[model samples]
Target: MAPFLTRLSGRAGFRLAAVSVTAMLALSSCGGSTSRSAPVLPDGADPHAPEVTEISALTFRAPIAAGIIQTSRGGADEEFGLNVTPQWIESSATAVSQIVAGDVQAAQSSYFGVIDAARQGIDVIIVSESYASNPGAASLESMPDSGITELKDLIGKKVAVVSLNSSHAVKIKDSLLDQGLDPAQVEFVELPYGQVPAALQQGTVDASSAQGATLAQVKDTLDTVTIFDYGDGKYNGMAESGWIMKKTFIEQNPNTVAAFQCALLKGTEQVKDEAVYAEILKTDLGFDDQAVASDIAPEFGATIRSEPLQLNADILKKIGSIDEDFDVASITLPTPDNCG
Candidate 1:
């Protein structure tokens, strides 16, 4: 298993990315045509601690990212007089790497990202599960024009995964194995999420699977057939990514992470209300389509479940993607005091 994301190091990447994320959110929220200036980084004590007066979050502009954004609703942090300033990163790899470099204390990425980073000797932990994935949330789709009508068509063909050793790759391999196909037989190429649709159209990739914005963006595209979506039945209950932090962050600022988790869980529960659901959909989640937003809203309670974790670990072990001794219990990072 090779690393699939940008292995960013140092503070320079953090500075530029921090500013970029703020602007990126402003643009996305403003429909990309209009400009909205980001607020300046708030004055603070420890920039890394959410318990501080101001804290920064690093994220990609995707659905899992929305889980953290939901915590900002109703000014949860503001109610405590804490300001959360979000910074943007290009991919999950960057998001987690920046956390390791101490650029930001908290961020979210696929669970395997923590394992991958741990192999590199970077201590990290899952503070909470951020995204409880739906079965069809991510997929590998092929062009009907390319004669890739079945899962077996992917044998000896190129498949697109945004990164290797990523949850997308894990799911694709899981789907292939379930179909009784040998995953090693398929060639998986790294294609940016935005490019996979075009690659399918051009016949460069036999299939591609995507989640979050990419899935929503291309859900209606024609002439493509789904080859491997995280579901189609085999993988029904899997937790996708965690709201992660460097273990050092959790250790040094236990109360900070505790406060963060409490507010997050509270926010998580709040959105479940129908009235709050609609408001979050339009505001923090940024769904232009009311129906679609409601369809994709996250269930916070789902994150605390143990079944999906054991299921996820078992699948990865069978694929040789995770260590044979990988333990689901160990992967459940400790929660802060007073956190449910």
Candidate 2:
């Protein structure tokens, strides 16, 4: 048995023990260890000020969202302010689940999660935008003689995804339908992200979904075929990730939320500048192999756009992931501007 805790609670005053995160706990442990001695905090950081001074958010370790919070300590040239302590969660799906369970006050999630929260009547509100350009960029790789070359060939084939109803599966179906192919023809199975490499080697799956960091890794190691790149013209304007929070929390902690958002946006602007990305990626994200696994561009912006979210809801409705059409504007809060 894997030695792990199914439920995790935040420290005092930020107690959020929500759900059983079986995979996140197990997989996160395998992530590369940090080489530095001291925590890589913002310059002149101070996290233990007071309830009024600190904001707590749950995100995956080394995610762009968390980096933004750490990079910009409230504002430029500000020695110390907006003391934020970022708690690491399992995945976007688990983060959304925790938001619904009320264990996580804030987390990074995609449109699939937004739609699910809408259908479940969860009072989750999206605060900031993380991505919007690339939809579900993936590649279906098989043996040279496997004879699986196109979408039509995927019929009766087993494709691996992180989860059954995950955004990857949903977007892959949308991509397939766009190609005038039947999505019901292909089969999908749930598998761990790490296990995909071995499964593909053993022919357990005809192809596996690849995105961002994982996609780069796949291209570097395997002799694979490129089936589809969702970031292209056909898949532009897809829903990206965003920071979500409970409505009540925004009502109660508006200042803290605004402060956090403004700081993150400043950091996002920094990320947009290519001149500083390499240093920041190595320092903030702790990526040892930055050359092989840099982040995919997603039209990262601070302002939340309604079009992508609406398009996502439409896609989810078509796939029966959601029952009714959702109003993206209703759940999205205006961009926070306390630091500016």
Candidate 3:
């Protein structure tokens, strides 16, 4: 695969590449095993059959990561004749760079980031849906002392987000338009998830957007008031993120893609059990607070529906994040019959 130009500014690409390499080395040193037993195949299956494919994937600690984690931990990939190793990534935007550079074969990617990459003429395809937004899944909030109790209060203030034109940012902007407030008047500061709570406490940003573990962190650590929930109104049930592979990779490895989708589909179903989901949060994701784990509501699925995808594309264009029209269907790979 040819390396595509990264949109990351300055030496961010190099930094992310270094991180990816380091993660690979670290995972390899441990024999690249999660220590989970592979599922028992049906009668007459060869126990010593070789794995058909091996893939490196990019993931971070989030609701979406749960599915990937389960795929590895529950031995779904092994059952499907695949060896999948997930590398931890710091920035979602850099996933494209890693995939194009051949550092990773797949990534749990943001819906908005995928759309943005396609608009830049990058060839990427959504292999499966990772997570969708449910009520209270994501929100914009402010510290108690910030006096920002409503959406209108954010008009001329700074808001912190993980990405500038991310789905989080777009939802907040769309909400502002609903309130008759100019979203442009609100400055968006991009900060790492770990730094967002500190930034809000220090008054660096008047409000901040958060989801998944980060949302739990802010609520547990601070007495923040919600300005609005992103998963409300028209944004409810929107496509939040998905698993993506380069279009060329999909064309070259159709069976591998199908195997991945099949494995991930089982993983998605595994996480639906409350006990299993909570255990993953505490063990895999390092969530110390039991309450936080129980409080989080994740909507995991493997099917890439067209309606939610199209809604996100329309929002991106309405918010001026993309100039040209995009058909979400064009960027999606039909689920192979074997995936079921």
1 versus 2: better lDDT goes to? 1
lDDT of 3: 0.72
Measured by lDDT, the strongest candidate is 3
Off by over 4 Å in 1: 1-51, 273-303, 336-340
Worst 10 residues of 1 by lDDT: 32-41
lDDT of 3 at 115: 72
Ranking by lDDT: 3, 1, 2
Write model 3 residue lDDT over 1-340, tens digit each, in one string: 1111122432364367446544544444333112222111233223224234887778765665788888877888888887777766656576766775566789877788777666555566788888888788778879998889998888789988777656788888877887777899989877766677888888888998877677877887897898988877887788888888876676666667778878888878888887877777777666777545536666888776889988888887777777656777777775545443
How do these models rank on TM-score, best leading? Answer: 3, 1, 2
The TM-score leader among the candidates is 3
Per-model lDDT: 0.59, 0.58, 0.72
TM-score for candidate 3, please give it: 0.83
Which wins on TM-score, candidate 1 or candidate 2? Answer: 1
In model 3, the runs with Cα more than 4 Å from the true position are 1-52, 291-294
Query: What is the clash count of model 1?
Result: 3
Residue-wise lDDT of candidate 1 within 1-340, one digit each (tens)?
1101223332355455445444434443332122212111122323224445555677554455554555665566554445555555545666666676687877767676555454434455666776666665566777667778777887899887766656778877777787788999989876666676677767777778766556655556644576665644655556776677766676666556666666566556655666666554455545677335525444344245666766766777778765554554454554333433
In model 2, the runs with Cα more than 4 Å from the true position are 1-52, 61-80, 135-145, 284-286, 289-296, 337-339
